[model samples]
Each structure stands twice: as structure tokens, then as C-alpha cells.
Target: MTYFVTLEGETYEEARESFSWDVPDGFNAAVDLVRKHDDGDRVALHQAFPDGRRERYSFDDLDRRSSAVANALESLGLAFGDRVAVVVPQKPANVLTHLACWKLGAVSLPLSVLFGTDALRYRLTDSEARIAVVDVSQWETIREVAPDCPDLEAVLVVDGEPEIEGGTVGDASVSRFETAIDWRDDDHEVAETDVDTPAIVMYTSGSTGKPKGVLHTHGVWLGHCPAFSMYFERDLEGTYWTPADWAWIGALGDLVFPAWHYGQPVVGFPMGSFDPETAFELLAEFDVTGSFLPPTAIRMLMDVDDPADRYELSLRAICSGGEPLTPEILEWAEAELEGTVVNELYGQTEANLLVTNCREWFPAKAGSMGKPVPGHEVAVLDPETGERVGAGEVGEIAVRRDDDPVVFAEYWNDPEKTAAATLERGDGDGQRTGVRSESDGMPEGQAWHLTGDLAERDAEGYLWFKSRDDDLIITSGYRVGPREVEEAILEHPSVAQVGVVGVADDRRGKIIKAVVQPAAGTAGSEELREEIRELVRDRLADYEYPRAIEFREELPQTTTGKIRRSELE
Candidate 1:
């Protein structure tokens, strides 16, 4: 009765029938990612620089450095469950900090380097980490935020030399990465942790206006394996990379852990910001064979026509999430990227990698999120009753929480919010699946975590993303999902990025409006605007087409690179 796929599957049904979860009593993130995999000189990562330099780090290098940093942090009074804020780009130091924190049984909170001073201060103050590992560029600013983060006691600066006698800055101790760990022995043992022991806390992109910390356990690694395998396929080769920021679960769970679990080297190429040309360069230069490209990245990559003719690329598999993978882009990837297949993934920080499409196992539907991956039950149900809706009807996606290892431990410290994610629904033929929260939970509810997304399941079992509950537009009597309209407009060559939202209207309750960022050298004009409007009208319903179109050089995006639809107004 099991439908679990072992990391490699010849057929979807065959794989699921043989799949299972095996989280052991004694589990450690460090041991799983670095300890057992390291054969001393096996390269673990390749850190690429903007200056065209690349440095390789072996498993032995990480093992030695992480153990030393673990001991150093422990000496500074960091204990089990203590949070360590790791603020850096995709670099060796960032990986080392995470491994070290896990080795000491501490929670690693990864914040993006793209975050400004205010965003950095907010996360530091909120997570209340006892220590922080930051880049040298942020050493001076860390002191400015230290007063606001009273719980933070130590700051380890990467790529900088310690300046002070005792390495003290304000109320917190500050020392360089090497200086802090140089005095400690590099042979410390990893902490013995349970499958349920908390490991990492990642903040959501806050597309809803406020960010919340999502805490996950050690079992998450086991939970991510099957889908990762499904998306990347068997016998992973060459280097794995993702343009997604390393702080997000898209990179950490989908690429880093899964790639490292197979002992494949990951490219930590932080280009400061995502550039389509630079991304192509890194993939070619490093011979990257597999990657998880975000939807935006793939869309931008489409701008380069005849890419197969332009550069030499080793990419064979590319899995994308964080946005819908429009058919236009998928077609472009398949046609121009040589052998790359773009499999779409669907999940949030709360529940990573729940659904995926596997190469050769099945044919991908245009813009479909694919079926639920092996090891998960997925259903589209009514938001209020949790009853299964008939095929072709939209419903909130929900995941069964009882014994679900991939579900996060809790919303960091917010019990009400954590409890809010789960609900008691009538268990009338309930299936495991993957939405937004309902205000009132029925008293006699079965445990199900809502994903806050709206989607429809076809008779064939493929699910298509409609829009976030908050982003759904109601104009007159017709209902519209912004994504449906956005995808239509994106098919037009001139459009690069767009955010669709419903604005208040006098005649209709709200009218659809699209704020678009055109392609480079393309101007937003009346003729172009009409073409975008006509494109949507021809593709989707007239109600879904934007009544108004505004042009801009850029759109507001969350730190994680998701468009902020709430800000479109």
C-alpha cells in the first residue's frame, strides 16, 4: 500500500511501490550532508567569484573548518537550540557556518546578502540569534544592528581580519572567520539529534506583507530526497547550481542538500543579482549539468534567442519553482537549451518539494504543476469543508500533517500561527495533498496543513496553479487568477516581467490592472499595450484580461525575488 519512490525510479508506479521514509532515531544534518559523504579529498563545492576566479573546497576542508567553528561557537556559550544568523551570499563561508551550526545542534537562520540594512536589522532582531556569521562588507553594519539585537553576542566576519584587541564591538564580540576558529581543535564530534530535532529556520518571502520564520527538523532532508531525485533524475552528474538565493528553501532543500546527499559538487556562484547572461556563463564555464532555475530566471533566459547556438552548456536537467512555469518558457528551454528539461516543482518553506514532474516517467502538461510526487497524497478540496471537489474545480491545496516529515516543526515561536496552519476537516475520503489559512477551524478537524494556493486538478491528476488566494481577482461576477493573466501577457515577446492585481473600481467591485516591465530596449507604448491586452483576450477570458496596463522600469520584488503583488497598487 506504499507509493514511495526510492531516489531512482524506472517507472512512476514502480518507484512509488518501492519507496519509503527512513529517518533514524540518531540523525544529524552535518553527518548526513558532510560526515558520511566526505572521502577526505572529494570536492564538495566550487565558489565562483565575480572577478572570474573559482575556488574549490573539499569535504575534508568543510569537515575540518566546520568542526573548528563548532567548537569555537560552543566556547562562546552557544548551546543546543541556540539560533545562529548566517548572513552571506552563496559562498564557502555560508556553507561552513551552516554545517558548523548543525554540528553543534544549533539552528542556522540564513538571510540574503541582498537585504538592505533595515531588512537585516529586522531579521537579526526577530530571530534573537546568540551569534551571527556575516561577510566582511557587513562587519561595520552588524555593529549598528547589534544594539537592536541584544541576544546576539558574537559576530564572525568572513574575509576580514580582526581589528580590535579582544575582538569586541559594542555589546557583541566581533572576530574574523579564521581568527574565531583558529584557536579551536578541528576534530569535534557532531551532536546526536533526533529525526524531529529542529535544524533550520528560514523566513518566508512575505508576499503577504509580513514575514514569519519557518522552523524545520532534521527529517526534512529525508523528506526532500524523493522529489529532488524526481526533478534532477538518477545518477546526478557534473555540478548542480541554482540562481535562487541560497537563503530560500528552493536552493537549500531542492539543490544543496539533495545534490550533496549524492556527493555531487554544488556551484556557489553568487552574482550579487541574477543576470540571464551571467547565469548562462556560469552554467557553461563550470559544466553545470543540473539546476533549479526560478521561474523569473527562465523567463529572462528566453530573451537570448538561439542560446544553443550561442554558448556551450552542460545542463541536462532544470527544475523550476517559486512561480508558474509558463509553456512559452518551457518550450523555449526545450528548443534552445539543447538537452535540458524544465520540471516544475510546487511547495513552500513550510513544506518543501511535495510535488514534482519526472523526466521520461510522464509527459508534462502546459503550465501544469504536475502530479504529487511519490510519498505524498494530493487533493483539491473546498477551503471551508475540506471535502474533495469534483475534477476541474479550484480548491485550496492541503497536506496531511499526521506523521508527515516534510511539514515544518512550527512557525518559529508563534504557536497560534503554527496551529493556524493545521485544521480539523471531516475525513471523508481525504487524500494527502497540498493553501491560504481559513480563519475558523472546524472543531472536529483532521490534521491538514493548508498551502495558501488555489489550484484545479484535472481528471488526469495534474494540478495547475491559479493564483494565491489573496491575489485572486473578482471583477463584476467573473473570477480571475493573476497568474493566468500574467502568463498570457508573458507570451508576448516584448514583456519581461509583470504583476497583475485588482484595483478598486466604481462600476465593478475591482478591475484587473497589470504593471509590466518590458524587455530591454523595448518601450511601453499604446501599440504595445494593446498587443498585450489583445494577447490575453485571445488566450484567456476577457474578464481575466487587464482593464488597464501600466509600464515601469522595474517591479517591486521580495528579497527572495518574488514579485510583490500587494505593492502593485
Candidate 2:
């Protein structure tokens, strides 16, 4: 039952027979998958620092270190299911802490290291985290905010001295992670937890309002790895790199879990800054076989003047997600990179990759999101009527949840929000409704997780993406999706990258405003704006073209490579 398909041009299949998981009552990802399945000598992680320092950890090293961390947490009397907030940059300690939590069956809440005292306090307070693992650099900031987070019991510093400040419970209780694991005779057994129990609380990218914690179970997360391996046909012995934070599910799904399950070594470069050349060098030096990045990073590499000569990319497969893959970028990768296939997948934090286009399926339809992965059913339905849409017609993209085990359990502590996303009826339409009735053996709303993204299913069963439902701009009585306009503008040779958003317009309600980052040495002017508008006019409908274009040096992007559209709007 393993699914196989060509992405870009190469064909691959999953090692697992099926995507289904019979969760064995109580499941622990770290123990069952990492400890039990992994060979002790296999390199689990290789971390390189910006200062030219490097550290490697084998599965045995990870197991022992994580066991010590588990013991330390237990010694502090923090039991299973207690929340532990971690605010550290990408590093070995960060990864180890997560593995430690998984071993203890404690929920790991990874926070962005960029957060100041105010932002950090919010997540700590919201999750009611009892322990905080923070970077030494941010220790002062954490100290400032720790008093406000009454639930915070201890602070584990990663790269500096553990000084116990006064006025905190039990003298600030800090532990330094620079030392090797002092494994004691204490047999730190992995906790037995229900498969449905919360394993990780991943916060949404927060493009709209406050970030919501999307709760996922062990079964759901583990189910994703096999699907990923099947999709990529990843070599079990090859090296993989995903320049994504573990906080994001994309990293967890595509990099961590699969690599661990198959015993492949993974490289994690965790600096706060991104250097395209350095990234390229890393790929070349490591002989990375498979790598995944956001389209933004790919575009950045493409924008480099001498990419082919500068870096020797021995990559077998190059995967991009977090946003739509532009045809221009795809074309560039094919031309410049030797025999590398670009794989694009469509997924969200709520679910791992539901649909993907492989490298063997190269020369794919320019705008299509490809076919649904086997074992899942995908449909395009009218948002209001819930009727399945005809080919090429835009509607909400809904995936059938009947047999899909990778779907999230629920939103953490937000039953009302969960109900809104999962329980709503499909307008009582027989054809469009994924749920038959409450008694039909399907949960009322859980029958389908309404992916707020809008798209169209082509005659070939391939899904063509449109835009997010909230991102549709209504201007001058005309509705427009920013993606269409951005795609149109991107056709202009002078435009390096463009972000389209709805700016306030009294006459038009909300006119299309495009922020463009021009090609090198290109000047921004009214003429350039008009030229972009004309290009859009040629490709898109008259109403969908950008009326106003603002030039920018760069555009903001998320860790997953999606444009921060909320930042622009």
C-alpha cells in the first residue's frame, strides 16, 4: 500500500507498506521510534555553529543525553504532561531538550529565540509552562520575565554559567547544558502515554491574530514520517538538511521524524541569520543528498550571480514548501542545479503534507499543487454551499478525514475554536458533505478539517491553489487573490520578488498593493510600476492586476519560506 509517484522526474516509494498506524494503545515517539528502531552507532544529528565549531551526536548519544535530561526534569518533580517552554536558537541542546520531553511524555512548547521579555512571557503564561530552557544570551531577558511567569519553576541555560539569582524559588534553579551527560544509575524509563495524548503544541505562524497552539498526538506525528519517506523516496543512509526550526511542524515532519525513523543523519544550522552562500557551502561540504527549504531561500540562491560555480550541490532532491513554488524559480533550479528535482508540497501546521508533487513529476502544471498523497481524499468545495466544485472552479480545498490518521487531535484548550474548524456542517449537501450524520460513525465536524486555503481541482485530479480565504482582496466590487497578482507581477524580468497585499482604498474598498524587490541594479520608479502593471494586465484579468506598486529592498518571510502577508497588510 506504499504510495509511489514521480516528482519532477524521479520515482520513489515509501518503505512502510501503508500510512495507517495502529498506535499500540500507549506510544512514545522517542522510545519506540528513536531508541528501539535506531542503531546505536548511526549518526542522528550533526550541528555546525557559525564560529566554525561543530558537534555530532549519534542515536546512542541522543538517547543517553535525553535520558539524563529526563532524569533532571523528573528530579525537579515535573511529571509527564507538564509543559516545558524552550526559547533557544537552533542548536544541539535545543534538539536534545525536545527529545528529552518526548521521552518524559511532557509537552514541548518551542518558542522563537527572537522573542523579547514581553513575547516570551505571553507564551509561558499561556502554556503555563513549569520549566524554561533558554539560551544564555537571553538569560537576562528571561530573568526579567520569569517573575511574571509564576508557573516557571526552573531555567536551563544552554551556553553560559548557571547563576542562581535571588528571589526565585529554590535559588533560580539553573542548569548548564555545556557539560556532557552525567548519566546516573537511575533507570529513566520512558513514560507510557496514550497515542491520543498531546505530544507537541506547535503554535501557528500567526499571520492573522494571536498564535494558537495546534495540538498533535503521537500517532498523528509519527504517521507523517512514513508518508514523507514515501513521497521523497529518501535514502535511508543519505544525509538530509531542512533549514527550518523544530518549532514548525514542517521541520518535525520532513526532517526530524523521518530521519530518526530511517536512521539517516541530519544537519541543523541554527544561526539567527541566513546566508545563502553558507547554506550552499554546507550542502556541498556535507554532500547533502536531500534538502528542503522555503521558496524564498531558493529564490535567494537563484538570485546569486554565480550559483553554479560558487557551490557544488550534490543534492539528489530539493524540496520547497511554506508557500507556492514560482515557475521561474523552478525553471532556474532545473537549469542551474545539475539533475536536481524540485519537489513542492502543500501542507499546514494542523496537518503534515497532505498533497505533494514529486521530482519525477517535473514539468508539472505551473500552478498546480499536485495530487493528494494516497490514503487521503481531496476535494474542492464551495465555501458557502459545500458543493463540490467543477474542474477549474475556485473553492475551499477539503480533505476527507475518514481514514486519514495524520490529522490533528484538537486545538489545545480551545474547544470552541476546534468545533468551529471541525464540527460545522457542509451546508447539508449530500455531495459536498464529508460528514454523513452524527450517527454515521463520523464525528460531526471532525469528518473534514476545513483547510481555509482555496483552490481548484483540475480534470486530472491535480489541485490548483488559489489563495487563502482571508487573503482574497475585494477592490472596486471585484475580488482578487494576491497570489494571482503576485504571480503576474513576477513575470516582469526586473522584478526579483513581489508581495501583493490589500491596502486601504476609499474608492476601491481595498486596492491591490504590490511590494516589489527588483532585480539587482534595477531602479524603482513609476515607469517600473507601470511596466509591472502592464505585465500583469497581459497575463491576468484586468481587475486582478496591481494598481499600486511599492518597491522594497526585501520582503519578510516565515521560517517555512512563506511570505509574511500579515506583515505587509
Candidate 3:
């Protein structure tokens, strides 16, 4: 077997002790991982379209097609370090774009196809991308925004041309993807890049502030080998799928990169509006063995009646991320979806998945984020003093950087923000510690990466998520996280989804406010509000319960499906 990381022992403790990422510099995704592990004849991607169309691409097909794309891009005058912004959906072209970028040492920036013209323009301008690869259906957005993005030099349509006038971006050229790669050779020399060379730049959704570009390097891709092995039980013989856009890091990092690195085929679909029935059909039809869905998607599926009896699911492992998973959803999944526990994964766009409740290694508890995966040192620290907090104490969740080979290189061109996010050891000044011998395997550093999220560690070492540091609620003298209150309210039989925020109050400083979307056929009333408040009070502390509840049919969300809590205020 090709050398890939795997569990070496029976328990989580032993697995952690054995885990290591012996990553080296000059790692190229196209040459190092894919070309090395992929057997030419095996399927690499299986794309199932909604209109009853399906296509499969073997590893050899991707290798040749991506090389053609690289040659085509180079012919267009694109060079190393050039940013190629891609606004395509979950099609095969999307995967090809990333692989082609790696071959040229160019940085690929994936923008959500759901982003509006304004959002699209902001990212294009911020990243200063020279070229854009977009779908024909979304050409209007590009045309409207391209005029404002002076840095964008050309546009490459994925399938065909759109019915629009030309000269959109100051005479910027437009061509179809198929036409560009038509005559190109099926092979190109992969660029030799150092571990620190920027490979990709992903932007935050700007739920709080202006979107910031998170830059990652080629070596970080190598780190995913151990991160996946420690937290995920890979089934080389099984199919993989994630119900998220390839633009999101969750799908790209969790599903695409690691799966291909270990030589496994992945399922892809153009995500329009998500329908539970269609999702069920795909899972059954494909006989998917491993998959992941967001918490919101799971909540919607739970409303479907008798899913277990309706569909024959072949799922062996189920996982979730993007938000905390509620106990109610987990119970439903275990009962209806092949008796598999939904593992809750935790991480940010800056740092891929750092923690998980990996069922293969450890048993899970309700509402906990589980332990830090091997190769990461995660702890709760005092935000003020930067000291490690004791059990049951609430503080910022941080990861020590010394041992992490995958921590992001930097926030794109923002040194001050990067410095602010880095944490010092204890109360001491941030400085370099002496390098440890290879036997210890620790890097030379005295700083930790502050995650900017609040959490607490239990006596058993499980980490309970609280809220984003800015999202912490301060009512009177007590601090509360909205997730804790939201989790309790979601357990109500009448609630479908909930978002908790801190509303201004003169006496208490800030009062707990719950904005809820009631379950179908359930009417929202004062009586139901009181019942939810009572439920929270019983499940959590008295002060933690919401003082006010406002009902809504649906909450505003970003393109990636995270709730827009700031907009609610």
C-alpha cells in the first residue's frame, strides 16, 4: 500500500501517541499527492447531476485534463503567484481549476457561486486576481462586477458562453473552457514550489467585518494526511461525498483533498436548493459509505417522516461541521441512518479541522466538540493573560503552533491582524523558545494561535463549545454563550432552528434574546415562548435562559449557510 497515515492502536490515547506528519518542503499537490497515489485506471470523481446526468472521471483522466488546463492557463500569460479566482459550482471543472493552479504554482481563490455582484467584486478586488473561471449561468454577475475589478484580465467560462455583450472588463477576453483546453497537450511540467509558497486564498463571509483572505501553502496540504487519519476512519473501498460547495473549506479540505490523497473516489453534484428527498435518493442510489452534512442540513432531514424505512442507506460514517450539532439531530441520525453516530468536527477557515469527536477512536458525548486531533495542542486559555485555564473555566479556544505543520502561513497581506491573532505563552512576552531535539518533535516557538472562539474543558477532557469571542453574552455579571442557550431551545419539539443574541438592556447590561424559526405546522405564540424559556432554565442555569423570544419564518444566512446574526441586530 502507498504510505498513508492510519490508526496504529486500539484507543484514542495510543493513536495520538503514534500520530505524526513527516511533511517535507517543496510539496506540490499535483505531483506529490495525486500523481503518486492515484492508479491511472481507478475512478477519481463521480459527478451526479440533478437532471439525471452522471459522469465519472478516472485518475488518469484528471491527470491528463488538469495538465491540459495548466498548459492552457500558461499560454494565457498566467505565471507563478498569480491569483486565479474561480466562481464555478461543484462541477468537475472546479476540481480541475485547483489542480491546474498547483501545477503552475499559482494561487487558486474559490468564491461561492451564490455570492452576489457586490460580494464577488469585493473578493476579486481584494485578491487582485488576474483571471476568473466562472459558470455560464452566473455570467451576469461577473459582467456587472468585472468593470469594477481592474485587476481581472480575462474570464474563462466552464461549459459554454453566456448570451451577453462583450468588452465587460475593459476589453477583458472571454473564452469557453473546452475551447481553451481543446488543443493543449496532455502533459506539463509541474512547478517546483517550497512548502511556504502560497497555494490558495479563501475569504471569510464577512458576517462580522470586511472579508479577510486566509492564505494557505502547499505544505499545509501535506498536514491533512495525519489530520484525516487521526480524526477520520478512511475506507479506501467506499465512496465519499459532502453536501457542501467546493468553494467552502469544509468540503475542499475534509472531502476532496484527503480523499484523493489516499486514492479514493469522491461524489460531486451541483448544489442548487437542497431537497431532503433528493439527498436521500443520492445516498441510497450511490451506496455512499462515508459522508458529511452541515448541522442545518441535518435539521431539515429530521423533519422527513420515516427516512430509515423509506431509503436503503449504506452509510458507515457520518460527520458534521460549520456549527455545533444538537443532541436531537444526532439521535435521529443514529436511529435512522445505519446506526452511525454523527461525528461533530470543529475548526475555522484559517485552520482546517483541528478537533473532532472521531467515533473510530473515542466515544462521543452530547454537545461536546471532542478532543484535539493528533498533531495539534488545543487548550482553553485566558484571553487577557494568555494563561492556560483549568477545567470548567471558560476562555478562548487556542491551538499551540509549535507542533502544527499545517497552521496557515498568514492572513493575506495583513501583518497587524495576524500578530493580534497569535497568542503568547502564559503571561510572558511572545518569544522563540529553544528548539527541542528531534526526539521531542516540537517546533521552536512560545506562541499559540488564538482561535477567537470561547470554550471550556471538562474534567474528562472533553471540550464544550461556547461561542465566538465577540458573540459571548454578558447579562448582569454572568457570561453566556449563545450556542449553549440555542442548543437547549432547539431540543423543544416545536422549534426547527434558533439563533441567540445579546440584546441591549439598561439594567442587566445585555439580555439574552432568542430568535427562533418554529417547526412546520407549529404556531408561535407567547405560550410557546414561555415553554421554551422554561426548557432552557431546566436544562441550563436560570440566568442562561432567554429573557425574550422572537419568532421568524426563516433567518437570514450568508452564501455558505451560516446564520447572519449581526444582520439580526
Compare the candidates by lDDT and give the number of the best one: 1
What lDDT does the true structure give each of the candidates? 0.81, 0.71, 0.79
Writing each residue's lDDT as its tens digit, candidate 1 over 173-244 gives 877777777634888888888768898999999887678999988777667877888787664766899877
Model 3 TM-score relative to the real fold? 0.94
List where candidate 2 sits over 4 angstroms from the true fold: 1-19, 162-172, 179-181, 184-187, 234-236, 305-310, 361-363, 424-446, 558-561
Which tens-of-lDDT digit does each residue in 360-411 have in candidate 2? 4334666666667655656676776565678888988776655465677778
Worst 10 residues of 1 by lDDT: 431-440
* lDDT, model 1: 0.81
Which prediction has more favorable lDDT, 1 or 2? 1
What lDDT score is found at residue 403 in candidate 3?
49
Question: Candidate 2 versus the native: TM-score?
Answer: 0.89
Q: How far is candidate 2 from the true structure (C-alpha RMSD, Å)?
A: 4.1
User: What's the number of clashes in each of the models?
Assistant: 17, 17, 0
Judge candidate 2 against the unseen true structure and give its global Cα lDDT, from 0 to 1. Answer: 0.71
